[model samples]
Target chain A: MATYKLKTPISEEDTRKLKVNDIIYITGTIITARDAAHRRALEFHREKKKLPVNLQGLAVFHCGPIVKKENDKWIVVAAGPTTSTRMDLFEDEFIKNFKIRVVIGKGGMGKKTTKAMKQYGAVYGAFTGGAAVLAAKAIKNVKSVEWYDLGMPEALWVLEVEEFGPLTVAIDAHGNNLFEDVQKKVEESRQKIYQKLGV
Target chain B: MEENILINEKIVDDVAVKLLQLAVTELPRDVKEALQRAYREEESEAGKTQLKAILDNMELAEKTRTPMCQDTGVIIFYVKAGAQAKGLDKIGYALRSATRRATKEVPLRPNAVDPFTQKNTGDNTGRFVPFIHWEIVPGDSVEITVMPKGGGSENVCVLGMISPGQGVKGLKKFVVDTVINAGAKPCPPNILGVAVGGGADIAMKLAKAALLRPLDEPNPNPDLAKLEKELYEAANSTGIGPMGLGGKITVLGVKVEYAHRHPASYPVAVAFQCWAARRASARISSDGKVEYLTHKVT
Candidate 1:
């Protein structure tokens, strides 16, 4: 219910204070990663090589950006959140390993990620799904990229962003999940609504 | 013998490129209006906010000529080629070429990949990518409709084959259940395409085709139209709302189409399109004239 303007690297205390339904506008450098990028990061971990960039206390967005090459630099033309559930398998480990404080994406993550959020003082912010152009406008620049072999959607994009969201805090550090709560409410009301319709 | 109209390969290529660009950047008029209405009708503050953001995103996308979504999607083209169209043989190649060029130009995300190798195609064309569905009609003009099926909604598409004994009630259950189970994953204020009573594949295709209709239009069949309305109400009543954040507008519209089925089987397919609902259409005549429809400017 409250709106907060926060900059990264966000303190563990700030993340722990967030509650589901709180609005957040983040101004900071956030990296973008999807399934491929997550796998590659894990690969980098196993190989004992340094990641292309440091991730501790940084935010990782679930995005596959549409980027164009302009005069030898990359331009993010349309960058929107991808479905976060696709990263469900890797998120818990990623968060524990990387100390990522904020995860932004669409469609929310799963129970494992929710548990991770609570245990690790992290939060999941749900950007409006399909709002690619709007999301891109928040990104000031594509600072760099890695794992290009993973393709655009799966590449790890290191971007500098400003006031990057009206992102809803969907999963909070207290273990409350907005989506899970909504699902419970709907399930509880489902039969009653059906009966009223005489279906 | 009727003389065949020779369509140059370049014409198909040109039309394909234009159609893809328009589909990616512009919100179809029907969709724009529907989202506007959703913004007005949404009672929840969060739902309203989400709708407004989507509307703003649509406008910005058009202004900047950037894709309305990052997915840019698995490009699917349905072509109704006239019998007299000579380059019917070349249309597939033309589409692949057009898709490849658009990946770099429109800068569509390189979505195509080798399933086995997990390697990106770099271009958007791959084995059966930019998937084409073709039909031969009697005229000398070719009509093409491009639907960019994003992964979020496409992942939630479902096909159910019910026993004929289960009847209409069972079919309704299937559709409602699909939407509810899908929850916020497919992206709400979604446009739902429901196809009933074909074999598995045909049912799925019919469901996708149903999505091409304008949002406000109901099925011509009164019975089907009633079903569409009923499902629409039932879905919204779930209160899954926009982005599944909880709201009154879970879906914008329900479009239903059906095919005759065997007495033993009742098949239902549901195709979910996010609020973006990106599609564009164009027609090319024998004289090499091209006309674009479904885009605001064209």
Candidate 2:
């Protein structure tokens, strides 16, 4: 239930203090990447090649943003978080290879991701899924755009952000899950509703 | 009254493109205001924080003329064509074309594809471009509504066929249980649309169509209206609150629609909508004139 405002390039100490279900308001640098970028990064790892971006102490946001450019400058239209579960397959390898400290998206990640967070001193934050326009306002600058062939919206656009989130800590370094907690509460409430209705 | 209606084929494409662009670029004024109000009244510190982020995102989208979310969703068009209108087939093609253009112009995510091959069609159209649903009515005006339903809430939709003996009370319990069980997965403070009666498939479609009704509109059936209120109250009682972070309001509202059914069947479908709820509509006359329809965009 504790709260903290995190600036990116987070430290092991900062990550350690964050427990599951805690609320975090994040600011600073975070990169956006989805399935394609994840796959490419893994392929690079498999080939033992030099990685594209420096991964140290960085947070990777799972997103595909709608962006437009004016005078060669790219601006985000709506950059909301995509479902995190899609990344469950490659997350462990991505985290381990990049030394990623925070992973932000929606819903819950799987066991492999949880283990990776615990081992790599990382945490997963769940931003509201449909609130893309809301999430995009936090970006102050588009530092770079990679994977242009993926199109403007789906491309991997590195962004500089400020006061970027009020993200829920879905998974923490301790391997706790807010999604599991809510699911349990939901079951309890379902039972109560059934009892009240005499069904 | 054998009136010949001249349907302007381009009207359909224009409407579809406008709807897709507006769905992302504009956060309707009323929706923005309501969300802001919710943010002010939200009691959970966490909930309020999430609300603020949403509000900020709305502002950014409006200022930059960007869409509200990355999952721009499948473009669904509900068209009520006047029976007198000619060229209905052309309108359908227009819709498909508009969806393709918007896919690039609005920079909508390439959400459409071959299910088996997992290959993106690139234009956002294929088997059912724009996912058009049509109803021919006896009128001189063509009405079209566009709704971009996101994956998160769409995944949470469910259908059940309760026995006739279960009645409306059972309907209420089922709806509450569905929402409660959904938890944070569907992204609460959601809008729940319930469809009663009809067969399984029709019930689900009716439930989705019910979402097109205004958020504040009362159910046409008095009994169903009462059930809507009750389910709303019971859902909030779960303390699922906004974003399921815990608080007073789990659902913003519940809308119910019913269709006549068989003697023994009582089909029910629940469609949950995330807070974004991006939808818009337009009405076109046989003479090619058009008027914007207001639902979410008041």
Candidate with top DockQ is: 1
Model 1 over residues B13-49: C-alpha lDDT tens digits? 8888988999999878889998999999999776777
Candidate 2 off by > 4 Å: A1-5, A19-28, A35-49, A67-76, A89-97, A110-120, A140-157, A174-176, B1-6, B27-34, B86-89, B295-298
In model 2, the Cα lDDT at residue A19 comes to 88
Top-TM-score candidate index: 1
> Local error of candidate 2 at B268, Å?
1.7
Tens digit of per-residue lDDT, candidate 2, span B222-274 = 97788788787788778676676666667777888889999989998999887
The TM-score obtained by chain A of candidate 2 when compared with the true chain A: 0.92
DockQ-based CAPRI category assigned to the predicted complex of candidate 2: medium
What TM-score does each of the candidates earn? Answer: 0.91, 0.86
Per-residue lDDT value at A37 in model 2: 84
Q: Per-model C-alpha lDDT, please?
A: 0.88, 0.79
Considering only N, C-alpha and C atoms within 3 Å, which residue pairs clash in candidate 2?
A133-B57, A133-B68, A134-B57, B24-B67, B188-B243
Considering summed lDDT, which 10 consecutive residues are worst modelled in model 2 chain B? B1-10
Candidate 1 lDDT score relative to the true structure: 0.88
